[model samples]
Structure formats: C-alpha cells, structure tokens
Target: MANTHEMTVPVTRPTAARQPHPSGRRLTAHLASVADDLTALWQRLEDDPAVAFHQGRAWVEAWREATGANLCLVTLEQDGAAVAMLPLEIKRSCGLSIARFAGTAFSNENTGLLDSVRLADLAPVTADELALTLSQAGLGADVVLFDKLTPATAADAPYSALPKVFHQNPSFQLPLFADFSAVLAQINGKRRRKKMRVSERRLEAMGGYRHLIGEDDALALRLLETFFRQKALRFAAQGLPDVFADPAVRTFLRILATDRDANGRAALELHGLELAGGDHEGEIIAVSGLTLKHGHVTCQFGSINDVIAADVSAGELLFYRMIERAALAGHKLFDFGVGDQSYKRSWCPQRTELVDCYVPLNLKGRLAAPLIAGMIRLKRVIKTSPGLHRLATWLRGLPVRRQKAAAEPD
Candidate 1:
C-alpha cells in the first residue's frame, strides 16, 4: 500500500547498547527495509486522524524517490503478532549514527511512530528493550530523534518518557467559514477587502494577473523552480538560511506535486499568481504549495517576488486568493505550516504546538544529547529574544563582507 522502495543497509558499527537478550520470546523486534509486510497496518494507522500528510503513502514514496535515503523499518512483535512499528532513516550526525523519521525536516507539522497508542501501552521495560533492539537491529544509531511530533505522539508512552522540547515556532492555522466573507471576518474584514482591492488595482494597472492551480506536471515543475528562486532571494534578503538549498529537495517537491492518489487528490499541490503581460511578462510573482486532506489545506511552502511589485503585497494577496479558494471549496482548516510570522498571525488565531522527542540509546548518545539540546534551546532563545535575533540576523548578513575583508589581507 505504501508503494515502497527501500534498501536495508548493513550495520557495521559495534553494538554499544545491546541487551543480554535482544530478542526475548515475549517481545521480539526485527529490522527490514521493505514495508510490504506491514501494508495493512500502515493503511489502518494512516486512516487514524492523527496521521498527517507527511506520513501518507504518496509523500513517503516521493521522498524515497528524491533522496533515496537509507530506510529502517523496525517492527516490534508481541507473542508473534506485530504490535508496533517505527519508520526511520539512518543518517550520520557528527560521529554518531542518527535515526530520525524520514520526513523530519522541511517544516512539515507532523512526525510520530506509527503505533503511538500501542507503543505507549507497551510494558515498562519496552523503552530499554527498544534501545537494545535498535542497537541489535543494526540501525547503528546512537540516538533516536523524532522532531515536530503532534500532540498525540507527545502524550504517548516511551516517547513521552524521553526528553522533549517544545518547538520554537508552532504552526499557525486559520479556521475557514462557510464563505470567504465570513472567513475574512476573523481578521478585519473591511480592511482586508480594501487591501485586496488595492492590490488588485495595482496589479491590474501594471498589466493583468491571474491565479492558477498547477494541474499539469510541466507547469507545476516550472512554478516550483520559481518558488525556489524567490525563496532563495527572500532568505538572502532576510539574511536567513535557505532550507530548500538541496537539489534532492527540489526533486522531492516535483514528485509530490505531480503525484495524485487513487482519489485524484495530490499529496502536494502547487498554486501561483502570474503576471499575464507586463515589463516582467509571464513572471510568477507568488507561489504556494499545499496539500488538501480530509477537508484541511496545509501550505507546505510559499514565496513572493517583491522585486516586481512591492506595494502590491503579492504574498498577502496570494494568500488571500488561496484561502478564499479553500473556504469556497469547504476546507475547514487552512494551515500556514510551521512558523509564527506576522502575516500568518494577522490571519490565524489558532496555533498548533510541536514537540521534539529525543532518546539516547548509548553512552555516545548520552554525551551528545545535551549538546544537541543546548544548541536547540540556544536557537530558541535567540529566536525569542528580539535583541539576540536582530544581532544574529546582522551576523548572518555580514559573513559575505567578513570573507571579502579577510581576503583583502594586510
């Protein structure tokens, strides 16, 4: 059911955290790459309301295709029947092998073990047993880190028992009403309408603009590239890191945007605003990638080209266009994904908190965990403290000048 393609890599490192009985009769765990055996369970778990789009079949397949990351399917069995599963990617962090959920990054709002409820209900020894099992299974990871975990996962057992930190930035959400007018009321309706009209007039006077949903694969890929460029420019302007810098990530976006499920719904959909004809003819000013699932619309990524029309507020206008569509289509929730930007807050009155769960499997992990946590916490501090954030932003913007000055040599 997952359309799986994964290869289990051999564990070469010494098992530093193995248990005396890694495979106890009552609780045995095995590792594999293929998920075909767990298709039924995957389907059942996916049907659960807590399962987000990131873990859906199509999204997983697209990710695998894009990066071809090493996969580890850890299945736990109780009395010969499967009871829990963990889908992990074996990655190298520092000198340690790190195990993380495949879709940990890229600002997705969810990641959790497939058997959250069951895993939590497992015996008290399950946590230690799991660590030993992971070591024996050859995942070769010193620790397991599941970031951006939903509330359900955070409230559950083994994970809940482990160290966790709340996400620095929670996801912002806008609740949709029966109509666009009603939805606009959540924010200042009249002000928004006037702003929209102003934006439309500016764009209309410049030439003409059109809202588009990229249904065709070719067009979608083109808009995705535009998004990349705009985002890079935006990040550079803001002196922020560009997370979409990876080539594999671009391929990943392309695959997801083009892939449609049996119901003809795509796991990722691309939408944009394009200038029909003007000085910058056929240029896309704004782009938004979204996923529509269970009547919810979550924006995965978005960008705007202010170089064309700064006064037009193309990004906000594009959001208005997208949210209006979601409202008209009867989508209940419009999620701005993970971040707390002023624009997102201006429209969203709801927020979803995320948790980062960390578990140290061995001595190496025990030593490294604190350093990692410290860095995360430090980042959070910097983000929350306006003075520190401004200072950091200034430093980021100075790297280029610093390099140039250093090169000038005495």
Candidate 2:
C-alpha cells in the first residue's frame, strides 16, 4: 500500500447552494468563500520539496507583485488535515475570466504541487474532488489554463480523463549534471575543446579575456543591466517581448542577486565575463545569474553577446564554470527549466512532459466549452506538425524588426 500521501481523494457533488443557469438545466456552485482554509493548504504543499519553483511561495509573491493578479488558494481537507492544494489566480479580461495556477504563465511547470506520497492511490479521485470543492468555493473562472505540467502530473492528476481535454503544445526540460567530464562527453569533448582552443587563440590575438563575478550591490546592478540589454536584443531579434521589458523583472533579478537564505548569505551569485583584444575592445560577453538554495542551483537568468568578437562557445563555458561552482557550492541539482530547444537536449538526458485539462459547470461553460475544445485541437495540430511549428516560429520573427533596429543602436 502507498503512504497516506499517495491516497486518491474521492469526489463529491457540491453541497453549497447554486443558481440555475439560463438554460434552466445546469447549476453553479454557491458555497461561501473559503480563502483562509485554502491559503493554509497552499502553504502546506509549498513547504514540501516535491513542488517546483514556479509553484513555490516566492514565485507566487513575485508574480502577484509583478502582475497585480488576484490570487486565491483552494484545497480539500479531511479531519482538519489538508490533502490537496491549488493556488489559482483569476484574471478578468474582455469580460471573460482566465483562471490559472499562480505564477504559471511566465514560469515553466504548473502542476498542482500535490504530495506524491499522499496521492499515489488518489490519482483517480483527485480531479473530481478538486472540481467539486472549487465550485463550492465560488471559483468562477470560465477558462483554466495549466502550462508546462510534467507528464507524471497528468498521469496522476485527478481530472485528466475528461474527453474534451486535449493537448496541443509541449515544452522540454534539461537535467543538470554534477560531473564536468560527463557534460563534456555529451557535448562532444574533442570538437568542443577544438572550438575552445580556436576561441582562446583569437581572444589571445586581441588581448585577453577577463572574467568578473559580481561583488556587492553596485557591480551586481551593472552586470544585471548588461544581461537585460543582451537578453532584450535576443528577444527582439526573435520578435518576442523581452519579459524583462518591465522594471519588475529587473527588480526581481536584483533581489535574487542580493538576497540570501535565512542564515544571511549571498542569495545570488551572478557572473559577468568581459572579452577584449586588438579590435575586440572591452565588452560584456556573457552574464549569468544563478539562484542558490538548499543545495540546488537554477540557471535563473542569463544572456550572451552575439557580436563577432565573442565566441559562440562562451555561453557554454560559462555554464561549465557554473556547474563546477555549483559542485563547489555543495548544490545537488541544477535545473535548466522548461523548453525543448536543441541546446538544452545536448546537456540533458531526462525529459518531462506538461499537461492541461478542463471541466465545465454551468450553461456558460457549456457554451464556451466548444471554443476551448477547438483551441485545444488546433494547438495539437500545430504542435504535432513540424512544418506548422516552423512557420509559426518564422512568422514570430518578422515583426521584431523594430526591436532589432532599436537594439542595433547598442
């Protein structure tokens, strides 16, 4: 038998009063709000190690501050002990409600932050129970979006069985390696070393490369600014909003740079490397800000120069050094986060899948259900077809000429 943590929760109908839909057939939940109870549930699950950073408390706070979202927690408890939790934020736009797990849109991975042990047997029961409970609590969102949920989460999730639920998009995650040699082997040691040699020779021909790990407040700010500029350039070239366009992004980065654990130590360790030589001139070539916590390090944010003077391999080198430093720092896992880019796969052997699902409650749900269903189907069509995805990527690259032109002045 699995532990209590692994038990599936049984679902029950909403006991609260509900108003009849216009169709006079369907019903909506009418239970009094239970935000307090739900918050406690969120805290309990967040305190666990199984949850990823996106679903963690810090991210929730950061997202609320950055997006000004209305956050609410929901949970199911038996005998006063919480069994499951969902931290959802509702956004109203265009007269429609968008419901999603707190901090999900920007961050990768949006699983319910469930206790695997407690849910082992309850996988079948979890979703239904959650739906009923949420309806009772007046979760009035017309659409609920869950992004980048690990595959296992879907398999174990309670409501994934709904036939209308469909998957259209997918992302990838890379594993962090503790062994330097292992990483080298994966990326083609001989070829990579040769490239490194060439870069070194070219760099030497100029002058020499300089590496600087930021120290103190001012220097950290400068390095972070450089990273933002470079990252924005990359996004503009690709025709996407540099998420860091908002000052909040910078504020968050700086907080990580200067923050520390409860014991009062450096919370952020940001690296800034400068490369200069004959015509090369001194310029920021690579910058990476890694968050360290509980023996784990995440490549939180980073950017590299695309200029000719810089080496394509510098970013890899910086990552290599980060791995070494992480080991030295006694960290165990390094997460590359979500995305299925080829570079990520070069270093990661492990892959996790994300999932989304839906259920309807009233006449409005019945009416909107088809649109949601169509979107899900269309998404699948686009994702499974390589040609379509390529076309999308290409189209995404076109409108960014303005951003690219703006960056050119840099």
Best by lDDT: 1
Error of 2 at 403 (Å): 9.1
Candidate 1, which segments miss by more than 4 Å at Cα? 1-28, 113-126, 239-241, 397-410
Candidate 2 residue runs with Cα over 4 Å from true position: 1-44, 121-128, 157-178, 204-206, 210-217, 255-257, 263-269, 276-282, 291-297, 327-332, 373-377, 380-386, 397-410
lDDT per model vs. reference: 0.74, 0.60
Q: What C-alpha lDDT does candidate 2 achieve relative to the native structure?
A: 0.60
lDDT of 2 by residue, 1-410 (tens): 10111112232232234332233222122222344444655666866765766676566655666666687665544334445566678877666676778756556556665766655533243334445556676787765555555555655644444333434544432334456555456446576567667766766776877776776667777888899899988886677766788876667556666655466444556787677665656687889876544555666677898875554567766776666666555566666665545555555544444455665545565467567767767866776678988887777666665656777865
> Residue 270: error of model 1 in Å?
0.5
C-alpha RMSD between model 2 and the true structure:
7.9
Question: For candidate 1, what's the RMSD?
Answer: 7.8
